[model samples]
Target: MTNLDFLLPKSSPTDLRSIVWPRPMTVLVTAPHPDDFDAIGVTLKYLKNQGHDIHALVAETGSGIDKVYGAGMTQEEKRQLRVREQTGSLRFFGLPDQNFRFLNLNNAPDDQVVDDEANRLFLEKLIRQIHPDLLFMPHGNDSNRAHRDMANMMKAIASKVEWPIALLFNSDVKTIGMKKDFYVGFDEADAQWKAQLLRYHDSQHQRNLRDRKYGFDDRVLMLNRKTATELGIREPYAASFEIDIL
Candidate 1:
């Protein structure tokens, strides 16, 4: 027989399973926009598979649709469509409507400079109510202004909280660089499921095509593949995160 053992890298004996929270923990995943959840879909799916209770919070309705979809549709119509699409996407992951919340904050380019205190308070209230053991948000170094703002807002709220909470930052498409501390690997089947979930964001698909010929599905696959390769993992795809204890 061929020297298969030598060809494969030696496995480490260290048990790193403790890095992830044990079963039955509550997780809160926050996204700057409806479709942003795809950035951390692999980890979310892994957490769900482990029987963890998870909730998704979207910071905005993605009101900049007119810039992407053109002037054909009204803002209200676009908003409603995005809401429906996100709802359907979450449903695919077995999340109930009650488990998903949308802040519906304005995402216009001009309005991006201002931070809404009311929205922060709303998020804090939700965090208090959920009392999640683990919280997921976009990384601070994300190139997207809204993503950076959301990270700052979460950090502010996390500073105010007294109890122990694990904060994990997911990588966005616009993320410049991140010091990844943890990773969740997924097989081809899981990657396909993630792609299917991304397609539920019909509005985002149109926007992605307008900007890039590829959609969220392709971007996610490429990101995950690159992440897996960088980490030297055998999985087809992976999602990386930076962990912090607060």
Candidate 2:
């Protein structure tokens, strides 16, 4: 019933090659934090290579991350650091800075997303303006609170919108579980490139190292490798996603 409906059965999760959308599409990727976008780099790269118009909407400044790791930094400084890292990562992938945007959404612990009218209206307006055929975001069942909130917010907004849109929910470091309805398989070279993309957020990388005994890059790739092996993908790594139409 949607413009993207054609992608349904044609795009199966078992495919080993890159995704081939029926036509060029406008894609909006929602990131709860700066580095979340890079968590699914290979898939986005494939979409970009297929001539799709891709834009990133970062929902948060990731100041909370700094609040934990940055002992003496000002809030503004923390926000700027994350923005710079995200911008540099996008540049590395050949995306123009103009395509990136910061929603600057508030993260008050007491404000539930469904009850936040302002955020709902803001997101509704932004989605209507972009009018994207596909939306990419982290899966809702993630361990990170921000990631879960953003995913639920997007789903809520999508349900009420007039036009139909495809949602590609991705896996992250904290993703509990998801159905792999689509995927992009990559080799060692591509895996290394993705790692570099994650490495751009050095602050997060160091935090991950100190807390998890590995860097942020490895944390992501470990999941990628496991996903590939679990799905019987021939590639050395794979970025899997669960797709839905709304």
Off by over 4 Å in 1: 1-23, 64-70, 106-114
Model 2, position 120, has a per-residue lDDT of: 73
Q: For residues 1-246, what per-residue lDDT tens digits would candidate 2 score against the true structure? A: 667766675645745243456678899998878888899898889888878899988854644354467777766677778888888899998888888887767656532122267877888798898888889998988877777878888889889898888888997868998988887888999999999999999889888888889988999999999988988978878888888898
Task: Report the C-alpha lDDT of model 1 over 11-120, residue by residue, as the tens digit.
Answer: 32111233433347788988777777766776787778788898998765545464756367665676677777888888888888899887766455543422568778
lDDT of each: 0.74, 0.81
Query: Residue 227 CA error for candidate 2 (Å)?
Result: 0.3
Q: Which pairs of residues clash in candidate 2, taking residues 3 or more apart in a chain or in different chains?
A: none
